[model samples]
Target: LEAINLRERKIIPAIKKGETVVLDFSHAITATHSFLTALLADPIKILGLKSYKQIKIIGANETIRTIIDF
Candidate 1:
């Protein structure tokens, strides 16, 4: 959760500045729903849903992709 908060602080501003954030999930085995939500939910709230169109998550397997899609 602390990590998520740190990233949110960094990422939200980058997105607000119209920077693209690419999150590569290649090495990650899995993520909890809470972790995923904490990492993204606030950014989505602040940036608006349209901002999500600019963010990218690569190398997500089916399970991670499914979680991300939600």
Candidate 2:
């Protein structure tokens, strides 16, 4: 699809150092930005994302974490 194509052709290049991008709506999911963000969290920190932002849902919302860790 277009998302896969964009990653193969475009977005990958922009994921380098000192990069700041805003993922909105369609591109957010299509680019699999959340997964990519989680995958690249350490690198992004090393590359210098002053504040590391990871999503945290409290209480009974730990299902995704369980799913991911499992």
Candidate 3:
């Protein structure tokens, strides 16, 4: 609930650009924020939700941010 509120208010702190975040949804769904926008963020993935669009439908546990260098 808190995270949703934070995101809604655009008060998210600096999360790493290459870290997998599994949003917690154990709180009230009515007040919880959907992790959709998160999917578009770099190094971010919408956990616990079905993958679609540009998101991959892999297991949350297996999902990770891979930064490649050449």
Candidate 4:
């Protein structure tokens, strides 16, 4: 949770500046719903759904992709 907060700190600033953020999940096999929600909570709250435009997710497997879609 602390790590997620730290990452959000960096991501929010960049997104505010209109920079694209690439989230690489190459080595990650899967993620919990809570994890993804926690990861995105701040950006979605602060920037709204439009924040999705600034976030690029790569290397996510089908299941992870599906989870993210949910």
Best by lDDT: 4
Which one wins by TM-score: 2 or 4? 4
- lDDT tens digits, residue span 7-69, model 1: 667777788888888888899888878787877776788679977876788988889888978
Predicted candidate 3 versus true structure: per-residue lDDT over 1-70, tens digit per residue: 5335554333233232332334433342222113434323322343222222223323222122221110
* Winning candidate number (TM-score): 4
How many Å off is the CA of 34 in candidate 1? 0.8
lDDT of 4: 0.80
**What lDDT would each prediction earn against the true structure?**
0.79, 0.40, 0.31, 0.80
Cα RMSD to the true fold for all candidates? 1.5, 7.7, 11.6, 1.6
Off by over 4 Å in 1: none
Sort by lDDT, best first: what order?
4, 1, 2, 3
Candidate 4, superposed: residue stretches over 4 Å from native = none
User: lDDT of model 4 at residue 23?
Assistant: 84
Candidate 2 vs candidate 4: which has greater lDDT?
A: 4
- Candidate 4 clash figure, as a count: 0
Q: Could you tell me how far off, in angstroms, the CA of residue 28 lies in candidate 2 after the best superposition?
A: 9.1
TM-score of 1: 0.84
TM-score of each: 0.84, 0.31, 0.25, 0.84
Candidate 4: residue pairs that collide: none
